[model samples]
Target: MRALIAVATAATLAVASPLLAATLGDDGLHKTDWMRDTFKDLREDLAEANAEGKRLVIFFEQRGCVYCTKMHEEVFPEPVLSDYIEENYFVVQMNLHGDTEVTDLDGEALSEKAAARKWGILFTPTILFLPEEVPEGQSVSQAAVSVMPGAFALGTTLDMFTWVNEKRYELDGDEDFQRYHARMIQERDNGKTD
Candidate 1:
């Protein structure tokens, strides 16, 4: 019994250690050292994107959301996807339940949690694609080009990334995402001969 207890205790410590090291917010999100940024800073990065003629992609997630956890653990860690995101988009990770204050590009100070609320971000792992400047006096609905919710496989995620990168949405329409994504998979399986 004593040996069993000791083993259980060790296992518990091993599991809890990493979580304890992570900074957890109200929404149960563990803010790790990597790929963590506030919404305000994300907006600033968006502005930089505008200046540099790039696109802005923001990922809103909460702690304890299974899908979000899967995304961070599985998809984001994939080398191809990670490398593409790091290079092409001004990626920002925001905690939905964090209370930290952030300053927007428009010089407005608001809590990160408040910003998530204002954006109507209730889902875990919601990815928002935005243009350089969120058109003047327009709401998020108008400014956002795409909003993808939930966790996706690396292949589908990469296809979405490629579609956005190539501005396929502009010509192909929103529903085309799935179709194009399917084709991408098929081509990859066929060794991308065409």
Candidate 2:
């Protein structure tokens, strides 16, 4: 009976462990099942996302990023956020200091590091939310509808994604992200919003 109980306990703990905890790639970045391995072409990624009825999201991360680790271990592992992201976004990961080639929407080909420099990305876990269509001659930096630059808790993270997915930024600037986030928080606290 003691051996059986020990086995059961081990199985339960294994099953309950955070799935993202053990998915670190050789690059030392956390990998998720939803992260798509792509050619790093913004235009093609957007097209693919559109075809899948998903949004295009660019994630900038680097080795030894503590905030990235926090996000992977805590925020993203939450089932609600993970399920929403997996279902609605085509996420492309970019190493902030890597040499992987990337093609910008404005037809600029550059290494990942250069692209980060060009995009003015200075932090790990900078998430770019791209619009469905990019204007001609516009770079990803210029065309991105929203950019989340740091780790956030579940409520804020979900609200950010939800706001972007709903295209609230296009509403004549009536409700900016801060306002939208505030309202959403209020509603959630009141148990009146999703």
Judged by lDDT, which candidate is best? Answer: 2
For model 2, the stretches where C-alpha displacement exceeds 4 angstroms are: 1-11, 14-22, 191-194
- What TM-score do all the candidates reach, one by one? 0.71, 0.89
Candidate 1, overall lDDT? 0.70
RMSD of 1: 7.7
Poorest lDDT segment (10 consecutive residues) of candidate 2: 185-194
Off by over 4 Å in 1: 1-43, 102-109, 172-175, 191-194
Clashing pairs in 2: none
Error of 1 at 28 (Å): 5.9
For candidate 2, the lDDT comes to 0.91
TM-score of 1: 0.71
Residue-level error in angstroms, candidate 1, position 27: 8.8
lDDT of 2 at 71: 90
Q: lDDT tens string, model 2, 1-194?
A: 99999999999998997565527899988899889999998889999999999999999999999999999888898888899999999999999999999999999999999999999999998999999999999999999999999999888899999999999988895689888888887888694543
